[model samples]
Target chain A: MAARERDGLKAVPYRSAYRRVAWFVVGALLVLGPVVFTPYWLGLLTQVMVFAVLAMSLDILLGYTGLPSLGHAGLFGVAAYAVAVLSTAHHASFWVCVIGGIVAGTLVSAVFGLFVSHVRDVYFLMITLALGMVVWGLSYRWIPVTGGDNGISGIPRLESHAGLPVSGPTPVYYVTLAVLIVCGVLMARLVRSPFGYTLRGIRENEARMKSLGFNTWLHCYVSYVIAGAFASVAGVLWAYYNGFVGPTYVDLTASSEVFLMVTLGGPGTLVGPALGAGAIVLLKNVMSAYTHRWLLILGAVYIVTILGAPQGLWNLRVSSPPRGTRRTRR
Target chain B: MSWWRVALVVVIAGATLVATAQPVSPPIKLGFLAPLSGAYAQNGRDILNGLLLYLDEIGYRAAGRTIELLVEDDEAIPAVGLTKARKLVERDGVHVMAGALLSSTGYALAPYIDSMRIPMVYPVVSADDLTQRKRSKWIVRTGYSGSQPNHAFGEYAYRVLKLRKVATIALDYAFGWESVGGFERTFVADGGAVTQKIWCPVSVHDFAPYLTQVSRDVDAVYALVLGRAALQFMRQYREFGLKDRVLLIGAGTTTDEHVLPFMGDEALGVITALHYSAALDTPANRTFVAAYRARFRKIPSYYAESMYTGAKWLVAATESIHGHVEDRAALVDALRAVKVADLPRGPVELDAYGNPIENVYVRKVERVNGELQNTVIATFPKVSQFWKYNPSDYLKQPLYSR
Candidate 1:
């Protein structure tokens, strides 16, 4: 009964030109948006770009692995703390700290993923939630080390680039935009790869993939690690951009916000999640400029969006014109 | 357009707007860099509302020019603090930036603003470093320090209440660390023995663990929690039967505006060290309160009072600069000349570090006019965070560079 499909997910229609247009739009934004706007807007745009990276990471697990892990924020927080402590306490170089943060996030997610590989369906979400709480506890209790509730402040900013001090928000925006573009391209390529096809196969029918001599659990485990690694990069970027890291990064809301971005944008699409994240981050900042009841308004919008745009915001925005590689599952 | 063009356009447009927006007749541009969103939004908004009320009351113009406010939300995040600070100074082109409520955010933004040569009149932040150690050429505080209330609490404990044994239970953060450290040093020097210190993490929802660890022999407990934690601790502290056993004096902010009403009976009789007692009987205080009530239809907070002082001071400095704020040194000199003695919180002065050395009051919450208001029992001699004894010595201590 469980094996039967009442309806199958239709494959996404492929469009290379559409992909080019998206890239062009992103490029245009990087240059024109910063110059035409103020430093405040540039800084605000940078934050949107950061959250977009995080949304893309969650898409890996939800879209590729078909495992909707609810606790990705735990990985995000882990990477942030790793970077902050390593750079601030251990005095690690910037590159070393970034790499260290990614590695730490991967390790943490991998350990949890190993146990979670045994659980299926709702159990996966429950186990991930529990694991996320455990990480939060560790950050809180390890006060002497993590700086506890006060958060790790006075974190050094990117003082210079390649030994040259890059002054102004212009340089910082360019750097962040470049990183975001690179990450987007990599994610798109990953989704188009042979490995990606196999993961989709697992998402479609795990039992069938198992019968075909493929260990579906290994696929899920690997996806978690990759997603965790990507999330770590986002976390490290957040640490660098903010110049401070707090335990709130590890909380449920962080994970929930990421989850919202993916689901709200287009959970299974490569670029859709990023668009959703960018939209949310930008709007959240601008929304406060208008009213103090942002949370109330956000709550109302959440209720309205889930009802209206449940299929994803990208779908709503892009009319009937379709995009992405449509792989038919036989 | 190519990607490079997009990036260049954004940078140029933003910079252009900021530079050109500088001079407008009387040239008073007021910008508030408080958290208008996120966790501490309400507090920032409260101060923002209060200051705007004063602005409206004062006709929102000073130095013969209309005042323009550019507000940015710090979101109570330290990381967002400097970015917002930079954006306000560089892009929004705010001549005077004021009112960052979080001490950590103020501490983080102080150096960045100084480097840019924009004098920031910090409102709500009580971190001692913002004035003492982190003192900059372009920064001034119109608010009290984290330890101001503790200065009075020390005197009260010694002279009036006669409490010999005390214990501090504070959140494990900068505000917590500095407040408790300041209070303990003063209280202990006055022959009060601090028993055992308990540090609760900021995210803690329950105080059972901390309450269980409190020593039974302590004569009083100084609880330092703010935001939702304060409400939780108050209810729990009373429920745990600890209120009767020991005096539940706060480290000041725990029983402030946000948590006071929600805390109810548990908050009654509890003492807090605050710069503004909300019930100050002075004429300046009365007028400030009346204006605040008319504008926001609510009582003003210490946070709001500080923001008002900072805003008024910044406006006075703006008049001195005569709309030519681009001259960094001139602007710095203009800021140094700002003196607001008739402030809502009584007399406040800015020393070299730009921190306010003001009166610290010890007030007990009493039922008055069908509401719990801070009843001033004693006010300490005006104390500067550059402490009478230490005098910026503690500021000289190396900042936690790590």
Candidate 2:
């Protein structure tokens, strides 16, 4: 794949120009997607973007920090339920609900991080998986607050944005796009920071980073919380988009899906996870329409990815930037 | 030459207008939402098969318009149900909706269906509030509510059976609570005592602990275990030696046809209550049973019968309005006004709240031709979700809970 990319890059003199034009077209299409596509596609794309944010957040922990937190959906679902409960029960304003969701996500992440900071690899995975199941149980059994399995519904979308009405799927799509862009940029910067290099160093050799007088625990803990906060953002967007939250969001299946996104997208590359989220979401919603055996197709995709492209679809390209650079660079 | 060309153009325009003015009706799109793949896939498939059977019998044409069915799997998840609901309405532009299995999915979908002004008929969702306090004008239910049949069975257990002391064991969930509540309310009202009540989790694999707690002095044991738990509970009930001591009675689902074929002699002599049983001997039901068995090669459960009847009810309403389903309000009004007398489940009519008022059958698990079947022993005709209580008074009370 690398050799093919090198040959293609050499063969095409205007490769960068072509990339620039491609990006512009993609950006413009996304911005005006609601105008051209039906509301169904818009709603679907909004979901893809929301999940992309979540997958990117998981990438921060699993890809960058080498923390395989299987229970990441716990953080995501906490935020979603928090926002849903606040908006539906308290009738709180939109900003208050979003803030509450982020805080709830971050706080839970902090607590989970504190507990799992001492563990790594499989142990970390097991602990996170259990913690995620705990959240799922809470959501399913806490009937009064979470509405149990029926879930809390009829949550209004962003009622207003800076005095402009934001009532329909079209507006929701734009808001999700904006949030995705902001999260993508911030995550990109975070991954390239000195702190990021330190995480990679710890991932490479944690004992060496500790010998250099760095608080390796603090780095992992902070990154864990940060990833959770971003996941919460996605959760909040999802609550508003779907106007509902249920126990399924906190279950192990959801956690595995987000983890799958990171692995399938090229875990180390932030862009790769986002792309993977889009691919999986589209595959699910669209393919299921044609065949009920779409999950089997998904299983096939995962197996092929593991066997064929261990680095994910993104790094398969020769244009991938050198190591230690901004992860999104092509 | 100029005069002839002008006349020719006028004639072509006249012919085009006449061709376009012919009465051409669009096909009615029906969107079906259910858990097509998951733990509930069997029930979902049954529902789909039942509905298809009915449509097939009618030649898939309703009220002078062809029916175009669009099926989407919710995977038994509420969020997925809502997403599919959106896709069905916004993308596929289905004129009517039907086929949801879960009470949770029904509730999750009610608000959205109302907001979209798409008339939906639920065949199997039994959530009480869907037709009670949280009732929506756009939604109609042809299936019995969670406690509908249980209420009738409870009355029978006290009055006809003359049971004085009954102990109950039910799965710990909303459905279980509601089922037991109905039985308890009527039994206690009719001057019978409930000796003991035990609640088991839905994931419970063993019933020994709860079974051990059943009081020995009770005249009979009333249970509401469902799905896989039903088989396990029945087996353990016999294994623990209580089956010989006390009569085993339960909600119709405990020995429903879906799981009845797999049950050993453990299910024999069990009495239960449900709206529809394949063993019903009515002409309507006999025809339906024969057709459903021929098509699916299995006895139709309440789930299949409910959707089958629901499809008939939907078609009745659509035909009543001559297939003008494009008018949302008229379609919903037509649904509310439908009174089906010849459905496979017997006579069914929508009560004031748009839930079916149908017959609740008290069935006994009897061996017929060496196969266990729910034979209709007694029938409570025109049973409502409100049971015997006045609608207004029933609305004032809290939902049935343990």
Candidate 3:
């Protein structure tokens, strides 16, 4: 027992030192990535950051609260469409577009949360799927507003708002990096908070949390809204970066894609989803460049990811805390 | 070890240098972008095969430069299309670009191509405004507009077919809306009343709900369905027993050669209008059909023919410039200025809007020599994007939608 405590004490400083180096390298890469990579790669990196934010937001619900949302893309797409319409049609200011988009996404999430907070497991998944399909149908059928299948195009990049110079891929990459870092830090803090512990407790045993007088439904509702807001942030960034928005964003393919990111990246940890997003975006773009059978290859990757690393790629190295210690953390 | 050995080596090096004295020109990179995956893969593959066949025929050489083809799949998404287009232009540094199967993708890539100042040939996109109000300076379309063939068909339907009443059903998107709008305007002008209109979503799996809503009293039903939906709609229309009663007529794509082989007796007697058909009995078409069939072992659809002719058009433009495609403005001007009378699709000339003015064929689906074909019934020669309407007046109107 004495030797085990000594080993734990010796490992603490080494882990901290390793973490510091990792942070330094990550910071350097984030700062220099745009400069080092070509425009195509820079564009891809921006997309990765956008999807990272989206996947992390999904992790908050699926990982912590045990709510597997199949409609997360609906939330993301609503914000993107909202931003696209405002910026392109109305020519609204950046602040107005951002605020309006987030609010629209949050409102939809709030309504969906009311219907889903009480449900569990497959029921929650089904309800979210139905709600998402409704959004997709609306976006596709409402021709005048949404531009139907063609979608609204030519959305200008931030347009030098406040003289930020975000017109090109390089500038956009920095902005996306900033957003990802902000969202990542906030999510990391959220998952380590007492509220986060309560969410985990609920995920572990909702009935037990209910008996302890916790309003699990209210917590779930609030978390859903928060996740939606974060997703909206990603959506707005995507709209500005891509300069286009379409119904495909809200489709089942997109929903399943984000779900796969969370599942494959390692749920319950914010960083895992981010890593998963990076992996998927890279795999998709890089593989397509070389071969036409990239989708088949992607399917193989998914099967291998599931079969080989069921606990996720992130958990392959990091040792998760024991259940007894996990509860004692707070 | 010897002056004799050094002298022989120097002589051999000199002989090799003299053999390669002429400067070799860099290969002209041509980027082909389309939906190579997803729902539109078949059409996309046909386009690529058609393009490859033409390149193969010419030995992939044009304007004294070796033409290097770079293919990218847009995946039928606008954003993906734009990204792939960027990679083709910015990364691959393609001298000229071509191929966009979907109208939405065509619209999405136009502005970007214009901003990048790259000459692109759109051989398959049928969006109307692409050559109308939203015409791009850097792009020229070798294919027919969405409403181009329909304009002539509507007039022919009212004047020749003597249809007094018609009902329209189309996929609920820009392409479908424009097609129906063109037909309605011309048919209405010719004293024909459109009795009913039905719009079905692209995701529609069953046509039973929409087919029952068709009015029995109408002279004909003008339907504009595409791809798998076209197959399902034709099959279900026969199942509903309405095929015998209603005179089934549609846009050219409703009975396109791409999906014609899979169709059964339900497709017979269905009249449609389009710019090209594999059954066209021209010498150029015969040569093209034979070559395409030999290579692909399948009948060349209008998609294939368009790309084939599109390749011819690009070659003509490139040759006119004497292979100096580095001059972007000259290349685009050459593309717009080229007019050919011997194309497989018949005579094609670009109008001021960079749209092709070509023959629109009113074809009937008939069993010809144990195979289904869009047999030409009537030809409306030199039909422009504006049809009989004034260009100014047409531009004054809003784009068709819903």
Candidate 1 vs 2: which has more DockQ: 2
DockQ of 1: 0.26
Alpha carbon RMSD to native, model 3: 4.6
Q: Model 3: runs farther than 4 Å from truth?
A: A1-12, A159-167, A319-330, B1-21
* Weakest lDDT window of 10 consecutive positions for candidate 3 chain A: A1-10
| Full-model lDDT for every candidate | 0.75, 0.86, 0.87
Error (Å) of candidate 1 at residue A134 is 4.1
Q: What global local distance difference test value does model 3 have?
A: 0.87
lDDT of 1 by residue, B1-402 (tens): 999999999999999998889744545666777887766777888888867876877687776677787777778866556666766676667776777887667656764675566767777777766666546676776777777667667767866888888887898777887788777777888888888888876778999999988988988898899888888899999999998888988777888865676668888899888888778899998998888878777777777777777777776776676656556677678777766568778887776666677888888988887787888888876777755666646665743221
lDDT of 3 by residue, A218-285 (tens): 99999999999999999999888777888888988899999999888877777678889999989988
Comparing 1 with 3 on lDDT, the higher-scoring candidate is: 3
B49: Cα error in model 2, Å: 1.1
- Give the worst 10-residue stretch by lDDT in candidate 2 chain A: A1-10
Task: Write down the worst ten-residue block by lDDT for model 1 chain A.
Answer: A1-10
For all predictions in the order shown, the interface RMSD in Å is 3.2, 1.4, 1.4
Sorted by DockQ (best first), the order is 2, 3, 1
DockQ of each: 0.26, 0.56, 0.54
lDDT, candidate 1, at A21: 68
Residue A290 miss distance in model 1 (angstroms): 3.2
